[model samples]
Target: MLDKLPVVGRFLGGRVADDAGWRRMEALLRKCERRPVYRAWIGDVVVCDATLARRALLDSDNCLAREPSVWQFGDKQRVPAATVTELNRWLHGAAARHDVDAAARIAVVALAAASGDLHRAALLAALDSVADMLGFDCNPELAAAVRVYIGDVFHAKLVNAPLDDAQIARAQGLASRVAALLTTCDADLPAVLRNDGVLTGAARGEVYLHAVLSVVGASAVMLAWLACVLHMDTVAGVDTSADSRAQVFTCKPEHVALELLRLWPPASAHGRRVLKDHQVGPVKALRDDDLVIPVFVLHRHRDTWPDACAFAPQRWHEDPRPAAFMPFSAGPGACIGSQFEIRWLAAVVRQAATLGSLQLVQVGRSPCANTMFSPPRCRLETP
Candidate 1:
């Protein structure tokens, strides 16, 4: 019923996440293409031009960031330097804590158990790795709840939307639960992350959610998309045989990952609140106004990328990484886990190639209904 009203369906979480949803978003964006920046259908100022998009992202004075909200990015009460340092250390060391091949094997079992539900398989696989890093046993129920709370409740907080009393209660409950779980764990933790008064109270939960959830969410979506693209390319004859697929994964996993990010970024669009009146390109903004940059449109802009819409990983061989490439966003609020996630995805992709040829069990998008634009559902089978 809501599908008829794509806009309404999308906002209310009824829109199907698929090619159709993307086309709808594209059509909305096209209406504003003539202007470098203009008010979108949702009333936020949209930046269409890549140059201006960069300016909007980089101009710390003109806009306030929404994420890394715990420590506040581009706002008063900045994220602590020590916190940042420790966090980076923990993230960088995560790879050394677990075996990538073991995670891939877990993913394969998860996929079969889920009947090809890519998100679940990916989430379960990520849980194993994160558990290893944080020195805890994988708790599927807790992991799934964290994913849900982040996607549903915490997202509202990011946007500064008012939650009802029930929602507020739920948020507090989940945070307390998460804090208790992490703080009381007896496993050996990384030095900086050790529970010796290092992380406690809400701060403890905030850091855990930020780091662990980020990995879980990113790994799930990226691996799912990796599977989707492999299957799609195989069906299209771009990957003529299993050997050819394996060759691409073996030789150029990073390039393929980059291409995937360009074509189907998980965070397809990002928004910021206009702090004060400012001019960016032709657009003038008043204080408290909202500005949105549709990374999806920017990636496929004809003027910015040659052969814009094609899923050609080989382009990375000659094409320099464009400024418009912002799968992890940009500026002060950009995802800190971006580099680690990319390398992790690449590692997992290499292992995936050895599993088997992929087949498209289902094709669906999650962006319309969720903040993360995860790829369609698919299956992996030995050919």
Candidate 2:
């Protein structure tokens, strides 16, 4: 019965971690313009082809694609189907009746807290609570991770472990700065993010997580300051001409946000398990085989993007290929937080544009590729 299963169907069952195997798969993707489908194996499962992979991803019915669980990590265990269904129903209902953006923010925060990045999780949660009037649902897993991520950041332990002295001090400093910024911004633009209605229970939880992310972001800014000092000269010529130099310094924070995302994507890659025997152009995949989709590689593919390696904000002024860019993956498994992120980026950029020249002062090494959000570490000094 297993042998008869589609190649793609088998990918659903096991873990796949083969470097060379993926290279071979990429070769197939490269040559697949002419053929509609092909076949391959992820372990014992036979995937039909790349076309099928794309189709499966695009099709909502055959595959079960839903918002990632707030507490789950990795492929080790599947979220109980019933729990996922219940969560989805609640989320959808909340989105329809209440503030969707607030809910989404909470979801991301909850997920981050579960990810073991405590500092970020706690800060985001606190910010959300204060700014959006929302609270986070305190799952045990989330609570434990939050403690680990924000040890010593807050006086009261929201998580199981206590943050050390250094972390606590850092957290306090960040919270103060973020609160000040939010106050200034709120006072300046009351109409943009108005708090009109009472937040639902879930909304409250979401706000808490947002606070955590904001605080974490402040720390990241300090780190970015250090990187800027070291690489100042390297990026100097990139902004040539007096006009461009002026523009660079005056560029809105949104532009900076975009540059940050392109430079350091949050999630390194997205994975999928083939559901049936299918083909993607020329490559063949077996049923249940796992397919590792590298968004970084696709984003920087020279053929797909002109000057793929360079960081040029102006490039966005032109039309970009949809397939080549998957900072938020395409099709069914795409990120639900995309809209919130875009809105936040725009707000940040708009604020920066109005302020004086924002100079980056790098303080530490760039963040390693882990966690869900890929923010740089630096400080901004206006002159």
Candidate 3:
């Protein structure tokens, strides 16, 4: 029934991680939240409210585990389970805590190197720096391969399309080279990775392979700071030029960051598969194989956040809803690196403020919707 309306179906089904699509998704989520669980004809079941999103995420009954297709790239291959959990522990727990400050410093250096309209290069470099802490950024060749393969696949997945045969083959070949590089590279790495006995020898190789290869997705978090800068300027009704930097920020950088993270998180959705028949809040999702919680829609819920879609930093001080917020998600599966990403976000904003001003090159445009930002191409200048 819903699919008949081309506009409505596309609006509901589209991944609105990009800036332009966020508002549309936000409105749809608001419209749909009248029911505890909403069904969309465009794709899968969606939960946009905070209460339901939280329950679905922290599902203790094990009714929900990660959707199988998430780790897939252009080829739709299954990432080994051992590889996923190990990288999660190493990247989220070990690397995030140890390297957040380094990520912050890298962000500063990468930002300073930009001369014209911004590109993904700086953000990629900063993300690569985070990878370095994990020993993935060492091989120049492997790093280059990761950039192409990871970026190509992540962008394509949003449209529900896989890359072409040639693209897939290139990614596969590069994946092999990268796997070899990571496992064999002599660079000193984290102790967890060094703990050879934690993994079987073959699984150990795959662990490092995924660690280095996946860095592209891992690093895309910094782009949220771009959205943060643009969002603040739009809300404050000020220009982001050298003379107006003072007017652009109404409060502390952290406060601005918190609000933007609420509205425009780097990662926008979490998906889980139902093991069997189960109920989550208002929705009986057990019938559906896939249950999706959209953080983009979840954060701005009207019931959860009054004045939900509006940019109001002051709300943080007044609201008791912080626990309801899910920028890093909720439950046992929540992102370990969230604090690390937070540091990168806060530091980016503060640094931009100190640098004088920033203005997106596409003045009237929004970024393309994807997992990471199209990392807005912008120009930052000094007064």
Candidate 4:
């Protein structure tokens, strides 16, 4: 079983805790993709071929692959026979539910970012209360479990505390109350709230937590990256007020997040089992075989992104990248929290750019990538 697997297995189970491991994984994929054997696999299953990856991402019928068992049964089913059908259904339903929560989370984060301290506290508490009603822990058990699984799968050392039910419950209650208050005021809502798909009854607390973590964590990383960019740009000793004009650009945190997605995406790869025999590129995929799509490689394809590895927010300034940039993925299996993540990240960046000076300092090793999603590590000293 995944839980019983060694450290590497646990890490692969998606509980990544640090940036070093993530970088290592990125390096490994880069190296592997260059080899012919690996390229064959990439072309056949991993979506390294730009055309194939895009097609698979956009065409629902061709891309409709079964969900991985880990998501449905957790680490417990790693040793046993698990039904792909059940896993697929669970994943689809979960993704839909997550999308709705994502919007709400983004709204709360944005409101907090724009408001005064008192308003921020009230909004945060309301958000916590809603989370409690939905059973989401701010610090979730799934995150920990995913971490342990990733550690075991990747042979990486685990580096997070076990899930704390009491703390999570308390945090949820506090957040929901704040969220409710924020939503009660029409002036505080984002434009997305008026859309049909923006909110759903499926907005449970667990999904809300996931949405919050996704946005907050991504924002934290982009903020670090932004500081690095600012420092590099100012190396010639130009007087750059970290606050004024920068705030204008900062308000669109989604833009910063889009850049981060292009740089170091949260998910490196995702797997789907072929429901029926299919051919991708020159390789034939058998039914029940897993097709591993490497988002890292696909995102960095030179054909899709010029200077693929370079950090350039200007790309988003031009146009949204094609479906090939599957940071949140595409099609039916796409990440539900994608929109919320964009909103939350934008809010965080805007806040930092407007209200405070953000200095990125190395705090400790980044969390080990024990989960499928890896968040960077850095300390932001605000002055």
Candidate 5:
């Protein structure tokens, strides 16, 4: 994991932290894709082949451990199975009660009214909407705390950078704050988290913290991407009106959302710690080596996807998904809220169609890969 350090990346291979480094890292991955598995840098091994990547990521018996980060709260070891189980439960419950169209409408309205960063507005709207779906009151301060954690602290971990002392302190404090907020705001939380005594003490708090992060963070990021895509399409002279959206995306709104995610997944790569010596195909990995699955490169694998780089929702009409597609990751560690996110994003697409023409107030650019694969700071303008 020390290979993620910018200095190590500068001397060894390529960096993955900022835009300049991300470009080099991505190119390095593409060049190395011919090898099924190879050392990416000093600390990590790259897994490029789809089949090997799946086995490395999905198989429980493979003896690979999840990379520990701030996501684990104070544990700094591994994500607890109980936390994942409870997170899935809470998100699924919210999905069951959520009115997709209504939520989309509200989010779009909030985006339109955004005075500054549309991404932040979309996130706040998502946080509030998820709270409403769960029958809880949304706290503005909590939303701010979440934003700080996602953008500053958690993002550093995602990009494999070290967090500062202030950031580390904030991460701990934020966990406690989220736990207290959940207990106060959501009545069903106790029942959902109790998990037959499995979740108590710090474990319970960890689960609570992740629940809000997953629901609010993932939703807002995807929604921001959706807006960026729509705005670009409109600027490219593609009509984005209701009737045209129906014709352009003949498959369904879900397909459109899938296409957007495929083009710009939020997380650039999924990482795992090799717990034991293993070989997938021709590449052998030793214990403690970091195995990285570059999600962006895999999504664009030419052999698996025809014209792999284009944004074509119609391809989904033929086959909604290919085995290589892993926007949320794969297997047990994959986000359980993926389906819920897709449904909500599809709803946003539907609502956006009614707005006719959409434009990005900021200059058009490729998705930013700093903290995550995100859009440039921009606002949405409907006309």
Candidate 6:
């Protein structure tokens, strides 16, 4: 079935993996580690060699450019360069940690207030709070609308299913309304977007729309991963007191979050459009085609990681950071918000842990999307 799809299909075409994709990826790793470079299709190559994958990712001369894997999944609104720069600037700035934690606190309280489990209502309710922190005029109802469009886009892409006309129209209308709201926000509300660069009229609206959606969507995906990790573990929860809030995350939650990244990186694989022909270790990648590094496969490489298939949080205690760690990718394009995301997710878990240890009811692999977005399905109950 994979062989029937295009080169990119290797990552996108399969039906949801039966076991969070670990079993399928492990089988592929066993086969791929035998060969440094295996052309999955004509021009698309799945680079399995860890050393070479790292080099290809760090290719500083812009030899390997980040390709739009998400766009291929039917998200028509593109994220502009200015929008990315602004969001990056804010997330990496001095106030970033404080701001993210503020947003997380809001989400936690909202999630806890909601009835039922950590389902879609609870997740979007959490995300809308983050949107509000970003200065959006978002309310619970508006947030629900925003989530509907986004959920459709992501779900369609993951399932490799087509969204009907009504679905697309509904999504676009919600997007436009959100864009209009962003356009009217305090002119200096996003000083980073305004002063640091010049984005005007339609461009400004588009950038703001993309940025807001990205923050909400990205946060939801990461939270989903956090849930997945919790489902797999028995991390004891504890209350954050006056003395504990500052230090609570320094302990178990960090290990739990890091292990999550290793096993279910938000983006299972990364794609680069080659700028020039070059040799990485032994593979010579030609230009004008996509070169993919399957992190899903590489992270489980038999020769690289002992007990590659096993989930081991203790490994982080042994080495706080692994050498070939690329859950956030490596080199220049590595996720600029890596530290921010890690701290934020850990804080979320640390807070939730006080309620009870995570009991994974189920781990649902989303219809095969570009990334490993298997949102962990669980019900929070005292164990």
TM-scores for every predicted model? 0.74, 0.49, 0.74, 0.54, 0.78, 0.74
Q: Tens digits of per-residue lDDT for model 1 on 302-328?
A: 777887776667778887888889887
Which candidate tops TM-score?
A: 5
Compare the candidates by lDDT and give the number of the best one. Answer: 5
* Candidate 2 segments whose C-alpha is farther than 4 A from its true place: 1-56, 59-77, 80-259, 353-367, 372-383
Model 4 per-residue lDDT tens digits across residues 75-183 = 2222112323332333344434443334345433443343222212223323342332222343354333322222221222223333356644444454343334333
Q: What's the TM for model 1? A: 0.74
lDDT tens string, model 2, 1-383?
A: 00121122123211121222233334443543333333333352222233343454565555433334231322333345564454344333332343434433453343233322323332443334223221122233344433433433431232112345877555444433433333223222221112322322323223333334433333232222213322354331133234433433455544544554554344434556667665554455556665544454455455555765555556565554344455555575555444444444444334332322334443323222223322223344433
Q: Could you give candidate 3's per-residue lDDT for residues 44-160 as a string of tens digits?
A: 667766666787788777777652333443434445677556556666655545555556566655655545434444445555556666665667775665566444543454332
Q: 2 or 4, which is superior by TM-score?
A: 4
> Per-residue lDDT for 118 in model 6?
44
* lDDT tens digits by residue: candidate 5, 202-224: 45555565666666666777777
Return whichever of 1 and 5 wins on TM-score.
Answer: 5
Q: Model 4: how large is the Cα RMSD against the reference?
A: 10.7
Residue pairs with colliding backbones in model 3 are 18-369, 118-378
User: Which candidate, 1 or 3, has the higher lDDT?
Assistant: 1
Clash pairs for candidate 6: 158-367, 237-353
In model 4, the runs with Cα more than 4 Å from the true position are: 1-20, 28-44, 62-253, 354-360, 363-367, 373-376, 379-383
RMSD of each: 6.1, 12.5, 5.8, 10.7, 5.2, 6.5
lDDT of each: 0.59, 0.38, 0.53, 0.43, 0.62, 0.54
When 4 and 6 are scored with lDDT, the better candidate is 6
Write the number of the candidate with greater lDDT, choosing between 5 and 6: 5
Tell me how many clashing residue pairs each candidate has. 1, 97, 2, 67, 0, 2
Model 6 / residue 74 / CA error / Å: 9.3
